[model samples]
Target chain A: MSPQRSEQLLLIPLRLAAMSAAVICFLIVALLVLESLPALNNIGWRLLSDANWRPTPAAADGAFRVTPMVVATLVITAGAVLLAAPLGLASALFCRFYASPSVAVVYRRLVELLAGIPGVIYGFWGLVVLVPLLGAWRPPGASLLAASLVLALMILPTVALISESAMRAVPQRYVRAAAALGLSRWGTIRSVILPSARRGILTAVILATGRAIGETLAVVMVVGNIVRFPSGLMEPVRALTGNIALEMGYASGDHRSALFFSGLVLTGLVMVLVLFANRLGHRGAISDA
Target chain B: MLDRVLTQPRAKCRKVTLPDRLAALLVWTVATLVAGMLLWIVLDLLRHGLPHLSIGFLLDAPRDAGRAGGIAPVLVATAMILIVSLAVAVPLGLATALLLSEYIRRGSRFAGFVRHALEVLAGVPSIVFGLFGNALFVRYFGMGYSVAAGGLTLACMVLPLFVRASEEALRSVPDDFRRAADALGLTRAAAIRSVLLPAALPGILVALVLSTGRALAEAAALLFTSGYVLRVPESLGDSGRTLAVHIYELAMNVPGGESQAYATGVVLLGALLLINLLTALLGRRYGAQVQGVRR
Candidate 1:
């Protein structure tokens, strides 16, 4: 065969393998949607409004209610982001401007290692450590407080890594220019470098938020998995992913379908967050280009 | 010139004094905080788990919470899952990477789509993968909550990471090697196998180790699919509990569970730290080879 023909032939198999990934993703979406539709049809929009979690009797045409879990997901995620964003950004800034190269590399590796530690470990740690610690302060340790702490730790690596990369990508010329214009080093970072990296940092926050929302094992271990509206930080609450994991095995009929519906909602949230992050990444790349 | 003269000396003075001190303080504070958190976590694990550590605990199956139960089964199961998942993921991931880096150009539409899709896949939650595995592997394939199903599901979860890392490693290999191999009348596949694959092995090893560490710690995806059986896996299809899942079950279901859970966690953490250190050492060794080739 000619060289060009051989190259073309090779490309065929490559395309086929790449296409397999797309097909898998499509299958995931389709399965989630199809399984969820039964519950969606039954619950209608009431699923979002009703905080009550009790599934009605089969004769009553009852559907699985998700409002409480949805609220818990949002509340815990927001609480986590609230805690992680500032600390992550601050750590990124410190790494960019403060640490020596050796120290920075060590710190970066630590962050990466922390990031790579599995969610199950985090859940285990939270259950043993954070929950009891919180219980002393409150009633039970397994509450939003414990969940938020674990979530914050879980998402910290995402935020820190992305923000650090963004900070590094900020042109040194901008900092030099600011210094030349009489701005202090910290002032330059605050006014110039951070603003330049804002888009990337925001993208990281979104990605971290998505992670916080979709987390299961860690949250489930610590969050108490109570299906109720969260009244306080110490109150145990159920989240969508946790609910799905906890009950997916025993769920029958509408309950099972409702669990799938929760997955669908979680997927939608993840897709949106990922889309925003992707757009930000592209914009950053284009601007750099 | 006068402005420059006055400003330069004053700026130098200020840098040596207030701003320098403040910057140093700020940096040290942040660094200390991060270090503190890491140390606290490690110390906590050791503190809680050390009391439960015994030869018997490492040898026997778990019993009642207060009684001495060993984590030998959990440790063995975790190892099996890691090996099985790596076996499944490494080849497919490397092949995908080879296709992307060597066989395709950077700006190809197909490459871009695959790259984006992989990112999306990487971002999908573990729970979603668990649901998929429960539906597809455990239920449809009749794996029945065995190590095989969990390992296969985790292979899917880590495949994106491997592909992206391997592609990166391949991309970092110099084009001169390929050109030289081509000049020697080597086939494309031969060049890749002889030159590129060897060059990228360290990076590929790094990716594999990282994925293995992740698989060892995975619990969410294994929750339903692995079925948390407290027994040694006799085969790939046997139900078993990983260290992570075992910890979860013990902590949640058993009384005085925290002690055993902590002990299992310590073992897992120790394994992870060792893997990370080994990966770093391997990366350094292979990194020198790639650097030497470049020079």
Candidate 2:
């Protein structure tokens, strides 16, 4: 073959792979929607509005209510993000402004390592340490609060790293401008630096929220999967993810379909958060330019 | 950094401000907390996990439903799954990345669409992948909960990460290098192979490392598709359990295997830490992506 022909052939495979990359979401969406068809048809909006979860393969009356799971998912996400966002933003500010350059570099690398460590390990640590530690206060220790704390730790690195990057993108001239205006150090950070980096920081929070929503194993390890609407931070709650994971192995019939439906709901919820996050991230970038 | 302080002569003169000191203290405290969290987990893992993690624990198969003996079969299963996933993801990821970065125009609508797709892929949760894997590979394709099914599902999960990071890596290579190659009368294929690939090699390697970390640490996607049978896998079709799956089962299935779960957790943590350290070293050596840790 001619060199050009060989090049064309090489291009074919790469193009195919790229096409695959482009259509992966289509495949996933199709699969989730198709498999979830039965559950969606049967459960309808009850999955959204109902709070009860009963799985009886025999009675065929087992309702896979999604309310508690959805509520728990939101609650866990809120609790974790509530703790993570502020601390993460603060740490980002600290690393960006207060730390010397060498120290900042090391801090960033440590955050990377923290990010690279997987969710299962976080879950494991939560199971062994956090749960028992919380047991002192809450007895079972595997409460919504413990899961929230673990998730807070799990997502802190993401929020901090993204926040740091965003804060770093603030032009030095602005800080200098604030200094010229006789603004104090904290004043400059709060007034000049944060306002400039606001879009990026919000994007980080959105991304971190998505991370918390999608997180499964770590949340499962700590949160007692009791399938009840959480009454308080110390109460046990089952998230949408925990429900799918718990029953996916041996669940059959409508029970199985219900699990898949929960997966669908989760997919929908996470995709929304992700889309919002992407929008904010793009806005942040555009504003930066 | 000091230059900024030095340049601000007025601020530098009265450097001992309360707010500055407070910000310094708070920042240091947060940094220390972050650092301390990492240290405490590892130290606690070592304390609880070391005694049970013997050579027998690694080489021997489980004797009593994971209550006693080693995790050799889990090791084999994890190895098989990782190999299958790596095989599928690495080639597809690099090719797609190359196509996006080199073959496509930078500002084209098609490129934007592809980027959007990869971003969507990244955001899709692993448990959702679990459901999709069960539907596509397990039921529809009739793979029947085999390692093949799990591995393929995981491949789908991490392929976007591979592509996104690798594209960033490829794009980071200066256009001057491609121009240099073009001046030498090389064809597009040859230039990409000889010049582009070399320049992007480190970034590509780093991408591989990140994807590998995701694959190895994954549990949710594998939970349904892989089928948690802690037996040594004989082939790709055999139902197998990874260390993550084993730990999940042992840790959650009540009180019998708690210590063993902790030991396995240590092993899992070690495996992950090793990959992370390798990624750090690669980033340090390659002079790329020290700042770019993808989600």
Candidate 3:
């Protein structure tokens, strides 16, 4: 065959593979929307407002409220981000600046190892250890506090690794210049290096927040999975991901659709967060260049 | 003379004061905290899990929510799924990567869209993928709750990772190799197969190991599509439980299931650590090869 003909033949397979990936994305979004439509039509927008989640009998045109679940999802994710941000940032700083070369390599490997462990393991660990620890100080064994702690652990690697990369990308010249001006090593890191790397760090935190928000197995294992307004860190709460995972199996009529609706909400939240982070990451990259 | 005067005061001030001591303390504290959390997780799993660890527990099947049962079936299932998923993913991923890096030019609109779509795929949560597997594999394909179904679903899950990694590896190959091949009247396909692929193998291997680690840990998607079963899988069509799914089922349903869950967790953790160590060893060997080539 001529070279041109062979090239054309290759394009056929390439096009086919690319098209397949696109179709997969479309199918995923379509299925999520289709499953969610019934609940969307039934509850209308009121699903966002009503706090109660009692599903009346199917014959009674059951009311399936989502307000408490939404609140719970936001609260748990926010709490996790709050817990993770400082520790992750500090670890990132230590890895980038304080650690010697060998220690830094070990630290990076540790983060990678942590990141690879399955979420389910974290959930199992949380159920065994974190829940009981929380229960001793509180009432129910499963609570938002337990969920948040597990989530914080789950997302720590994402936050630390991304932030570390960002911090490392800050120009060495900037730090050196700051120090040459009589600023101490700490001052250079604090006043100069951090400000320069702020965008990257922010992007990392946002991504970690997104991960925490959508986490399923770990939080489900510990968050009590109760659909109610969170009373405190000790009270059981249902997150959007946990709700879908727990109920999608047995749900029928509006209940199944409601679970899909939860998935839809979770996807929307993740898309927004991811897009925001990507934008920030792009700008950080440009600045670094 | 002026530079010396400017530098002398800075040196004198540095000798008298610990300017960055507080910041250093803060950084150390943060590192300690992260290290502490990781240690705690490992310690907690061992502390709770070790009591349940026994020969009988490793060999026998789960009996009840509370007591000792072996996880051999679940271990086998996890291994099968991991191997099956990687088997399906690696080739397809490498092909797509080759297409993107070697065949397509950098600025092609088609290439850009494909890249963006893969990023979107990567960002999509695993639960959504599980739901997709439910609709497509189980419902449409009539696969039911089989290892094949879960494996295929997970293959799609890791496809983007492989493609991205492979593309990156291919991109790192120098243009000189392609030019030299062209000078010898070699076709693009011949050059890519003989030269580019060899050079990119190490990076592609790293990506494969990473994806395999991910596949082994996944549970939520497998929960519905894999359909947890206590018995050993006799065939690809048979339903089986992974260690993660087993942990989830037992922990949620069984009273004092915590101990059993911990024991299973230790097995999973051990698998992950082993994978990491193996990857590190392989990566180091590959690193030396790349350096040798550079020299």
Candidate 4:
């Protein structure tokens, strides 16, 4: 066969493959919308606005609002990010500037190991170890605190690795110039590196936040799965993810559609996050150029 | 000015500033604490799981709602699910990646859209994927709850990750190889198949290993689509539990199933560690080869 003909032939399959991603994205949105239509039409915006979620037929109240769960999700995610940011940034700075080459390599490998650990294992560990420890201090160990702590550990690697890369991407000449200016190492890092790497670090934190929001099994296992809003760190609270996973097994009809609606909301939230990250990434690229 | 600046700080530079010292101490403490946490998790799992983790435990089937017995069936289901997901994801991912790196221009709208789609897909939670899978595979397609549905759902979840990694791998192949292929009158397909794929093989393998690790660790995505039936899956149509799901169920629902859950957690962690080691080895090999070429 002619080379051009072969190339044309290959393009058919390649283009089809390339189209798969867009097609899948369209299909997932369409399916979620279609499946959740029943509930959306019935419950309308009340599903999102009200703070109740008693969807089971057995319950005296059949309201299916997710405001409280959404709040719980945000709370745990915020807590995780708050806890992870400092630790992760510090670790990233350590790996990039503080640690010797060998130690950095070993340290990075260990963090990567932490990154690779399955969410369920973290959930398992949190449930068995951390929850009980917290429970010792405050009764009912499986609270927002336990869940946030687990999630913080779960996302720490992402934050640290991304921040390290961001810091690494900063030009060496800038550091040299800061040294030429007689700035101390930390001063240089603070004034030169952090400012240049700020966008990247923010992107890392945003991505970690997105991950914490989407994580289900890990948070589900630890976050006491109570439907009410958490009054404190020690109180049990159910997140959007936990609600769906814990109830999806037995949910039917509107309840099931409501669950799908929850998924839709979760997907929408992450989409915004991904777009934000993409914007930062593109702006950073343009600025660098 | 340069001489003055250098001379002025020459003595001062010898003594680290307080903030520098404090930053060093903070980073060191945090790194140590993080390392210690990892160590504690691994040690705790081993301590709890080692007694229950035996050849028999791996081979036996749960006799009582996972409160008793083992995870042999779960292991089979996990392997089968992984096989199905890889079967779907690898070809699709490789084709999509090739299209991106070789066929499509970098700044084109289509490329951008595809990338954006993938990023969105990657950021979507596994639980949402589970719902998507449950809706499309389990309900729409009439596949019901089966390994095939679960695997296909996992394929959707991992496809973005796999494609992105594979594209990076393909892009890492130096442009010289393409030029050389053209100089030798090699067809595009021939050059890609023989030259590019071979060069990028290690990197692609690393991607595969990493994607596999993610899929293996998933439970939420598989829960609704795969449907947790504990019996050994006789076919792709059979519903079966994965190890992660088994761990989740045993630990959360099944009272007195703590030891079993610990053992399962260990197995899952061990599998992840094994995959990470594979990735490191493959990464080193790829790094060496690329460096050799550069040199």
Candidate 5:
């Protein structure tokens, strides 16, 4: 066969394979949307507006309020991001500026290792260890607090890794300029480096947010999985993800469709975050250039 | 470092400010605390789980809803899921990586579209993948809750990660290789096959190892697609349970299942440690090869 022909032949398979990801992504969205349409048509805006969640066989009879779960999901995500952002930034700063090179390398590897540990394991660990610890303070060990704490730990490495890279991407000259101006180490980091890397850091936090929001098993295991508006940190709350995972097996008819609706909401939220993060990341790159 | 160098002459004249010292101390403390927590988790699991984790535990099938037996069936199911996921993901991922790096122009809109799709796919929750798989592979395709369905779900979940890693691997192969191949009048296909792929093999292997670790650890994506059946799966068509799902079930649902759960956790932790070790080894080897090229 001619060389050009062979190359052309290879491209055929390669291009087809390349299309799979896009196709798969489209298919997932399509299926979710299609499956969710029933819930939307039946429940209408009440799905988003109501706070009641009583899944039943009859579509009209069930209250099917996703608001509480969505709120819980956000609450957990917010708490996790709040807890993780500072710690992750601190770890990033330590790795980037404070630690010696060898220490930084090992520290980085360790953090990456943490990241590699599965979400399920984190949840398992939380259920085994953290739940009881929190239960000591509160009546029920499983609460939004436990979920947030485990999720914070689970996502800390992501935030740290991304933030460290963002800081590293700051121009060397910027650091030199800060030094030349007699700015203290902290002053430079706070005033110049942090400001310059703010967009990247925001992107990191946003990505972490997406990860935390999408997280299912970990949140399910740790969060109390009670469907309600949690009044306090110790109160058990069910996240959108927890709602799906815990009930999907038994859920049928309208309940199953409602779960898919929740999935759709969760997917929509995550996609928005992903898009936002990508925008910030790309803008940061362009501005750096 | 530059701060130290620049401030050395005035170090004696100007005292380091309180915030500077405090910030440094804070980061160090946070780093220490984080590391300490990681240590605590490992130690606690080992202490509680190590006693029950034996070859017998690994090889025995569960007798009573996972409270009394070993994870032999779970292990087999895990391996099957891993096999199917890797089988599907590796080739598609590699081809996509090749398409990204070798075939397409760098700034092409289509390439950007593919990458965006991957990024979105990567960010999609594993549970959503479970739903998608349940709907598509299980119900629509009528595979039911089987290992094949679960593995196929995992394949979709891991594809983005594998592609990103492999693309980086392919891109790291020096352009000089292409030039050399061109000088020898090698076809594009031949150059990619014999020159590029070999050079990128180590990185691609590392990617494969990492993806395998991820696939093995996944439970959310598997729960619906791979139904929780404890029996040793006779074929891919049989419903099976994975170690993660087993641990979750034992920890959450089964009464008096804590010991078994701990034991199962130990297996997962052991797998994690092995993966980390493999990654470090391959990384060092890849580093050495890259340095060789640089020199």
Candidate 6:
């Protein structure tokens, strides 16, 4: 074969690679839209806003409101993230300014290992252990509170890694400026460093939120699979993800389409967070450069 | 002014500074707590899960509706899915990364667009991937709920991670190797194939391990596309359940399956820990080698 031809052949794979992302994106959105159309056409916009999600075979009279699952998802996501951010930020701070280099390195590796563990294992552990610990608050032991704690653990790594990077990126000159004054170590971090790194911290927390909402298996195993809106953190609740996993096995027709619709909602919510994360994260990168 | 802000050691200033110190202490405690939590989870999993694991459990197919049987078939299914996903992701991911790092200029519109798409891909949840895989692989292609469908879905899920990591791997390859290759009259393809790729292999291997861990642990996307059929899969056409999905089914449905779930989780955790250790060793060696070459 001619050299030019060979190069062109090589370019085929390269071009395929370049275009694959776009192809995957279009395929996911298009497939979701097409598959989800049945639910939209049958139930209209109320599928999103209505909480009653009883999926009977009768298409006309079936209730497809998923408000409870939606709320549960939001509550779990917000609650878990609230718990994680402080812990993550603190860990990041300790590593950046306080820990010895040797200690920091090992701790960092531990965090990485934690993050790399499968989501299912987290679910498994929660189901076996964390849930039982919660039996005092909720009889069945599978409550939103347990799920949130597990979710918090699941997201701690992301928060720490991102926050650490952001903290590291703070100009050393600013640190010197703070130190040149009478300010102590704590005061500098509080007054000068954190404010400058505010955007990164927010982005980190948002990315964690994205993970919390998108998580399925862990939340599925612990949150009791109840469809009712959570009355408290101790109450059994079902997130949108748990709902789909619970019913996708036996669901047919409109019930199935409603599951697809749930998937779309999840995809939409995650995309928003991911998009913002990319935007903010890239700007942070540019600023660092 | 900076000194004024700092040197104001008056009572009010001291009170404000006290909160800062307290907050610092509070954060330190929280960080320590997080570390303690990690140790606790690992130890707890080992304590509860280690007892249930036996050689028979590793090799026997689940019995009595996943209550008494070992996870042999589940392991086999996981292995099959892993092979399928890695086969699809490794070569394609390398090429995509090559395209981004070598074939395309970084600041160009197309490159930026692809990067953004990758970020989106990375963050899109597994459940959505499940839904998409179900619609496209299981329904559109009429593949049914089988290993083929689940594998394809997972390939899509981890492809972004592979691309991003491989791109970094490729970029980390020193430019001098390419320059030397060009001086020897080697073409771009030959230079990359013979010189740069070898240098990037360790990093790429790290990427491979990480994505492999991802594929091994995925449950939701596979549940719909692969189905919950719990038997040894004879071919790509056969429906099979991965260990993750198996654990989910047993733990949630079977009455006495919690112990079994813990056993499977131990296996899963062990696999992950092994992969992370492998990556860390490679990462350190790779870092040192790169530094040596640069110097």
Best by DockQ: 5
RMSD of 4: 3.4
Record all residue pairs in model 2 with backbone atoms less than 3 Å apart, i.e. clashing. Answer: none
Candidate 5 lDDT at B4 equals: 36
Model 4: what TM-score for its first chain?
0.94
Best by TM-score: 5
Clashing pairs in 4: none
lDDT of 6 by residue, A1-289 (tens): 7767877889887888777877898899998888788888887777766557778654576788798899999999988998999888888877777666777788888887778777888888888778888996558789989889999999988888888788777877787677666566677777887899888888888889999999999999898887888898788999999888888888888778888888898999999987887677634432110
lDDT of 5 by residue, A1-289 (tens): 8888898999999999999999999999999999888888888887867658888866877888888888889999999999999999999988877887789888997788788788877898899899989888787989989999999999898788888778878888887887767787788788988998898888888888999999999989988888898789999999998888898888888778888988998999999998988888633332110
TM-score of each: 0.91, 0.93, 0.92, 0.95, 0.96, 0.94
lDDT of 3 by residue, A22-101 (tens): 77778888988987787777777767665467664251366577888888989999999998888888888777767766
Model 3, residue pairs in steric clash: B57-B70, B60-B70
Question: What does candidate 5's lDDT look like per residue over B1-295, in tens digits?
Answer: 5533443324554457999889888989999999988888888888889999889999998888888879999999999999999999999999999999999997999899888888888889889999999999999999999999999999999998899888888998888888999999999988989999999999999889988888888998888999899988999999999999998888889988988988888899899789879977997899899779978
Residue B149 displacement in candidate 4 (angstroms): 0.4
**Fnat: each model in turn:** 0.37, 0.67, 0.49, 0.74, 0.70, 0.64
What does candidate 4's lDDT look like per residue over A121-150, in tens digits? 999999999999999999899999999999
- Compute the lDDT of residue A70 as modeled in candidate 1: 89
Interface RMSD of each: 5.6, 3.0, 5.5, 4.9, 2.6, 5.0
lDDT of every predicted structure (CA atoms): 0.78, 0.82, 0.78, 0.87, 0.87, 0.83
Clashing pairs in 5: none
Superior candidate under TM-score, 4 versus 5:
5
Instruction: Give candidate 2's error at residue B236 in angstroms.
Output: 0.6
Q: Which tens-of-lDDT digit does each residue in B1-295 have in candidate 6?
A: 2322332334242344676568767866886787788888888878888998999999887889888869898888889888888888788788889988987788988888887777778888898899899889999899999999999899999998888778888899889887899899887889888998999999999889989988988898999999889899999989999988887887888888888888888888888778878988999999999999999
Error of 2 at B145 (Å): 1.2
Indicate the residue-level lDDT of B180 in model 2. Answer: 87
TM (chain A), candidate 3: 0.93
List runs of model 5 lying over 4 Å from the truth.
Answer: A48-51, A282-289, B1-14
Chain A structural similarity (TM-score) per candidate?
Answer: 0.92, 0.92, 0.93, 0.94, 0.94, 0.92
